[model samples]
Target: MLKGNAYGHGASVTAAFLASRGLPLLAVGDLTEALDIGQAPQTSILVLSPPLPEQLPLAVRHRLHITATSPELVQSLSSLAQGRNQKVTVHIKVDTGFGRLGAAPEELVPLVKEIKKCPYLKLGGIFTHFPAAGGDRIFTAQQLNLFLKLKEEVCALGDCDDVLWHAANSAAFLTLPSSHLDLVRIGTLLYGQSPVSVGAEWDFRTTWQFKTRIVQIRTLPKGHSVGYGRKYRTKKPARIGVIPVGYSHGLELEPLTTPLRQIKHALGQGLKGQHFVFHPMGPLPILGRVGMGLTTVDLSKTPDVYLGDSVTLSMRRVTASAHVPRIYYLAGKVKCILANHEVLSPTGRKISLLGLF
Candidate 1:
């Protein structure tokens, strides 16, 4: 599943790659994203939040599954479906106490009743989104309780049949299986990382990595200033390596992970450079300010390396601002590509982390 420019990983490209891996189903935030990847046969599409009536016809034609919540929209969908001589499959979203979408508990009775009469609309599934599936047990429990309640009600519907009840995203599927469900729409998990780092028990294996080379090396006298606004100054006459990826490329300098804390000392003999994780307990802590097209690597200790040496940036989804090519892999081999499609040479890799926000 992909949404919000795919949480910084491009949606269209990511969806295509996941589809290549037999993902089978995809969830998107809106109608546009749904249609973008809807045509693939055997691939189910879910528009997390769909648009209004005026904008839904094209999406229906593209074979996307629009998420339905209200009776009015369900009726509208049936009408649209009648015009197309097609039955529109809808994934009914239940709020499950998140106060977001789906019919409220009291409203479900009437909504389900109204939906059963729509001949052209099929109840593909019943589901909800968990607000704290990765962390809060209390809130997660409440949501799960509400989901089970609705599941019973939907199952009781006279003509509803056996609509799938799916309430788990990656977090819920991994940590809370009461909602493991008939189907799960996972994003970060398939990408092999946690969407949130703090308190998350991560088990998914990462599928890809990012790396670039140092374009140049510069040595400066002590106290020399560097970068725009001169954020960092050379304390001692030191050498700095210029990497070909920076903040503009989706890098967040300083500490991009969890609660930033100062470490006492690094491993090895006098490891000079300090290191930090993206989020406390985050799987990857590898990022530099995404430069216009480069990153500033502090290589004072590793100054003996040449300009052509490469540094791989372990990455999950970067921000939309990061307009770079994405290399994909499956089972330790190059499988597919997104953007430019420049084949990367590195075989062994690691996933680098940056904060979700």
Candidate 2:
């Protein structure tokens, strides 16, 4: 899945590399993200969510595999495709138990029949989402059982046995072997973050890293407060290093609004500590609230650390700011860089990541 800017790892660059390696289909959230991946003639792109009514034609024209969550949408898409003299591929979304976007179990037969009736539409795939597969085993089993029964029933109906079915998300793919049907729609697993602790045993390496350099360093008095609401105060004189990445860059801070909560946090800090940046010697504790563009880390322990020294943190990749540049490498060498709309090479030559396809 190359949705949410490839989980904030630069969609175009990731899609280009994956497509070059012969990825059959890349899924994105909507048409805009599909457009961001640019033109890849050989690779198929699936839009996981329903596009707007006005955007359906564009999706058909682009040959994007679209999601059909309802009979109404399937009928509308069929009309549009028929009018354009185009055959559009569609995946039927089955809401086995997720209770989100998807046709109900009872509606499956009619939905499939509707798709078969449309001469301009092809039933490419069927799929569901698992909201509790990561944590709730009984519920996940129920959902899986329901989907399996539906899949069998759908396939038993005329000419639908070959319709592809998928349900495994990152967590289901890892923990529930039965959930792996035709294909898996893994997001967190692809980025190497385990949805559950069982994944820690797997030899999955992270493909993304968040790093920034200290932009400012200064010493504050023993009782100096840091960040908004004076949330943190130094017990002794301390040195602080300011990092460029902050909440605006997708670093989340815990909300401490009440005075009691603030006091509890202050008491807990001495024992449990808080979020920190990694260094060779030790971890540097982050001081107080993360601001929009700046985060302060206590640097008293690492006196050798200076301004411009790199500070690294493990962040939720999907939430990171998309405007930040993503540098792609192959064989441990620089291949390309993507920033917003521009793609560049190591030598500073402008290029398009999609142009390679």
Candidate 3:
């Protein structure tokens, strides 16, 4: 899955690399994202979301597979494909348990029949989504059973024998192996994250890192106020380093929608005493509230730390701003840098997106 800008790791670069590794098909969230890749990958691209009526022409013209969530969308695609004298492959999405963006189980048969009536539309696959695959095994199993039963009914029509059936997301890919049907749509696992824990056999290492350099260093006297609202003050004379990263870059940002999560966040904040960033020498405590674009760190403990030294940060990858530069490395060497929507080599030469791999 190469949606959400490849989960904020930059889709163009990620798609090129994955294509080089011989991935036959890539999936994205929408038609716009499919166009964003711009022929960088030599593979079939599937749009996993239903396309708008206005977007169907572009989708069919580009030969991008689309997910059919309703009979109305299927009809729109059929008309566009017939007008263009082309065939469009569509995967029927059933809302087995995921309550969003798919035809209900009861509606799948009629939707399938509707697609079969359209000569320009071809049924490439049928898939469903899991809402709680990681935490709820029984629910996921029930969803799978429901999908399989519906699949049996769809196959009885004799036209969908060649249709691919997929339902496993990353969580289900790990927890419920039975859900892995003809194909599995894995996003988080490809990014080296697992919603469910596995044993030692599954050795998944983190594939992305967020880092920033110290741009400025300063010394502040006792009782000096720092950051907005003066939420923190120096207890004594201390050395601080400033990094050009904060909430805007997804640092220290998390969802606190539930009361339990909010309470857990509060308890975690109290237990940690102070937020810190990682360095080879040791941890550097944050000095004040994280700003929108700048954060202050206490560097008194790491006397040898200097300006331009890089420090690793804890950030939600998907929430990180796309404006931030992503430096890709291979075998301990800088491979390419993705910044401002361009891919460049370490020597500052512009690299063709098609030739990235």
In order of listing, the candidates' clash counts read 17, 0, 0
* Count: clashes, candidate 2: 0
Better of 1 and 3 by lDDT: 3
Ranking of all candidate structures by their lDDT, best first: 3, 2, 1
TM-score of each: 0.75, 0.86, 0.94
Candidate 1's C-alpha runs over 4 A off are 4-23, 35-41, 194-204, 253-292, 314-322, 340-357
The number of the candidate with the highest lDDT is: 3
- Report residue 45 deviation for candidate 1 (angstroms): 1.0
- Candidate 1 lDDT, tens digit per residue, 1-357? 687556656566566556666776788888866654434444677788745878778778877878877878888888899998998888778787677877677777677777678888777777788877877878998888877877777677665565777888888877777777788878767666775553545456545445666678888788877666665677798776677666566554334343332232223114733332221122222223234665565666553566777566644344524357655555666644445323233443332111100
| Candidate 1, backbone clash total | 17
TM-score of 2: 0.86
lDDT of 1 at 237: 84
> What would the per-residue lDDT of candidate 3 be over residues 1-357, giving only the tens digit for each residue?
989889988888888888888998889999998987778567888899998888888889899989998888988888898999998899988998888989989999999999999999899999999989988999999999999999999999987777999999999998898999999999999998887778888878778889999999999999998898898899999899999998988888855756777887788688875778988889999877999999999998899999999999877688788889888887879889888888899988888877667
- What TM-score would candidate 1 get against the native? 0.75
Q: For each candidate, what is the lDDT?
A: 0.65, 0.85, 0.89
Model 3: residues with Cα > 4 Å off, grouped in runs:
256-264
Q: Which candidate, 2 or 3, would have the higher lDDT against the true structure? A: 3
